[model samples]
Target: MKEIYLIRICGKCKKTNILINEEVEDTIKKGYYISCSHCGSKRIFKENETSDLRKCMDNNVYKRVKGKIRQVHSI
Candidate 1:
């Protein structure tokens, strides 16, 4: 399986901000803050504020599993 990453979308620039799982955890424990790299907007260091990279990429209409490719549709 491919490694998944955490991401936060910038509200102002609509840019994706990637985050390390370990770093996020540590930051939450220490009450540190995070910001958007593109627009310099402050971000909350909460799990609910971020999303999994896989979930973000689910908008793709196609997917590949093993050696085969298939179509995907969103409701």
Candidate 2:
């Protein structure tokens, strides 16, 4: 059976990282690399990567799409 992985889009890079489990899902952490959608820069999220990501939906930090493919978001 194909496992469905929950992914969180990186606000900085817009790169989607498959959420391993509830750890990353419940609370948002920083230090992970997310690819930028513009310059293709592998950027790191601050402490509020989770919250920041949610804000990105409106603030335009990042956008979510229906696929697993990685979309690079640049500054």
Candidate 3:
């Protein structure tokens, strides 16, 4: 299977390259938004939406397989 990488979208530039999930939450505190590395959009980390997302995988849409991940590698 092909390898897939994950990234959050840039609201301004609309670039979906790489993702860093709330990496700056500690420093920024509760009332702050993370900036996109490419376009500096301040909405990259939408806490409410991303809260229910699984950290092991990137996208919100996923399948509940009984065995291993269907097309994933390295667990």
Task: Give TM-scores for every candidate, taking all chains together and pairing residue i with residue i.
Answer: 0.49, 0.26, 0.35
Model 2, 1-75: lDDT tens per residue?
432344445565455454434454445455454443455555534322332334333333344467543334434
In model 2, the runs with Cα more than 4 Å from the true position are 1-4, 23-75
Model 2: lowest-lDDT 10 consecutive positions: 44-53
Clashes of each: 0, 10, 0
What's the candidate order when arranged by decreasing lDDT? 1, 3, 2
Model 2 CA RMSD to the hidden true structure, in angstroms: 9.3
RMSD, one per candidate, in order? 8.1, 9.3, 11.2
lDDT of 1 by residue, 1-75 (tens): 433466566666555566776676678699977778767988433322334545655544557888775535433
What is each predicted model's overall lDDT from 0 to 1?
0.59, 0.43, 0.47
lDDT of 3: 0.47
Better of 1 and 3 by TM-score: 1
